[model samples]
Target: MNGDWLAEGRAELAAERILDAVRMLFVEKGASAVGMAEVAETAGCSRATLYRYFDNRQALYVAFAGREARQLIERVWLNRSINSEAGRADQLLDAIASVLAEVRKTPHLAVWFEPANSGIVAQLSNSSDVIDAIGAGFVAGYRPALTDSAARLLGQWMIRVVVSLLTLPGGGEDEERAMLRNFVMPFLLDDTTTIE
Candidate 1:
């Protein structure tokens, strides 16, 4: 048991180091340009060693995106703020807007939404169960009355909206807020709920 634990720890550490190398390359060259061999060299590990951890470049990209997504979720969740006067609909809108602002501020993450890379990032996010679950949790927390299926669907839609905004931001914060409020809030929250 002790040996197994130690091996697992070592393995996780190696993978983390590899991911750190990848982050540097991503910031320098953009995510699309990174390759496994370049990552291996940057990590000071053999290609064989890198491949053992991640089967290919796509796997590595997914792993990195997954890690960043988790961090982004945590950061947004931790800093979530809802005014007492704000209704449930307003609260949900706030959460969605918060995610967009945070990602834009985070350079490492924001790069994924660059014009050249946005499509790929969107595809990865759609396919990632982790990303979907985070979105679902956000919706379920706000709307406990929703059925599982309904919450899941809403969550997927919320994530897509975030991706869309990231890929192509509105003219300004006012425009973005209007888009969310006028278009998304109605579908997400009942008419009985107050906007403020």
Candidate 2:
């Protein structure tokens, strides 16, 4: 049992190292352009070793994105201040702003949002179970009465809004906030709204 635990720990560390190396390459070159052999060389590991951790480039990208998403969510929640008396809309607006700021400021994350790479980022994010769960958790927090399916749908919509903004920013923060408040909040917060 002890040896098994140790081996598991080592495996996780190796995977993390590979991910770290990949982040740099992503920043230097868009994510779609990166390949497994380059990742192996950058990580200082053989291609076989790299494949042992991640079966293919897609697997590695998913792992990296999932890890980053979790960390980003944690950081956004930790640093954001929510006024207990504020309306749900206000709280959600704050959360969105925090997330946008966090991702924009983080170099590794910002790269993924660049126009050249945004399509890949969107595809991965929309398909990722991890991201969907995180987004659903946000929906549940604001509207606890929603069914799981409804919340999940709304959560995905919220993610799409964020991605759209990141891919092509609005006039400024004020404009962005207004767009969310005027356009998104109505459809998003309306209990009677049905998503198909």
Candidate 3:
């Protein structure tokens, strides 16, 4: 039995505890309501210790959110959207759908991405590995000339649009997906696709 395993396990457990505290506070109150002190208190760590792990509240929230986005983009979106040999345009639309589908299912994550939170999140966005991936996914093969601003607009728009769809009280899944497809294709589908 390797004692190194026990050391690594303790590190993992502490990281998870901190993240759990962040999630609980941010969910119960908006991201604005949670601060480093609150997180430290909830996580059973001293403020100095929490700061040792994460520099600040925005750092903690952004890091956690970015990590979640990366996993969702890779596991759920990339896996579901990109076929073995798909072109970039098809991959882009499918990736958009996959991300929105995830946001629809996980509203709490959506809260962290809200415009109200954007002032802080936007600052952290400059360093986001996940947003970088999402942006790169948009720029690849589909539209090499696409501007970064447009990609950002489209990404946030997709999330807002999907939230509207899910808030509709009641609707059949097929019908909703079809409705989403019809509404989204014009803007998101490749300009090369002929609309009938």
Candidate 4:
């Protein structure tokens, strides 16, 4: 039993090290452009070992993205000061703005949003269940009355909005905030309305 626990610990450590190494590569070369051989070399692991941890580049990307997305969500919530007295729309705008600022400042994350890489980012964002859960969690904070399916749908929409802004930002931060406030907040504020 002790040996099994030790082996598991070691495996987790090796996987984390590989992920750390790949993060730097993602920063330098952009996420979509990175290849498996490059990840193995950067991670100081044999291709066999890298493959053992991640079946393919897509799996590796999903793992890395899931980890980063969870961390980003935690940071955004931790740093934000939510005023209960503020209107829901105002509060939602603040949350969106905070998330955007966090992604923009994080190097590995920002690289995912670069024009050349945004397509891959969008695909992953749309497909990843981890991301969907994160979005649902965000929506739940604001609309606790929503059913799980409704929250998940709204969460996905919110994520799509964020990705759209990241892929093609507005004229500036003020403009982006204005767009969110004007366009996104209304739909969000009405929890009774069905999406699609």
Best by lDDT: 4
lDDT of 4 at 36: 93
Residue-wise C-alpha lDDT for candidate 4, range 131-175, written one tens digit per residue:
999899788777788889989999998899999999899899999
Per-residue lDDT of 24 in model 2:
91
Ranking by lDDT: 4, 2, 1, 3
Question: Candidate 4: lDDT over CA atoms?
Answer: 0.84
lDDT of each: 0.79, 0.83, 0.62, 0.84
Off by over 4 Å in 3: 1-9, 81-91, 137-196
Model 2, position 106, has a per-residue lDDT of: 92
- The alpha-carbon lDDT assigned to residue 31 of candidate 1 equals 79
Count the clashes in each prediction.
0, 0, 0, 0
Give the candidate number with the greatest TM-score. 4
The CA lDDT at 146 in model 1 is 76
**TM-score for each candidate, following the candidate numbering:** 0.85, 0.88, 0.60, 0.90
Worst 10 residues of 2 by lDDT: 1-10
lDDT for model 1, please: 0.79
Model 2 regions lying over 4 Å from their true place: 1-8, 78-85, 194-196
RMSD of candidate 4 to the truth, in angstroms, is: 3.4
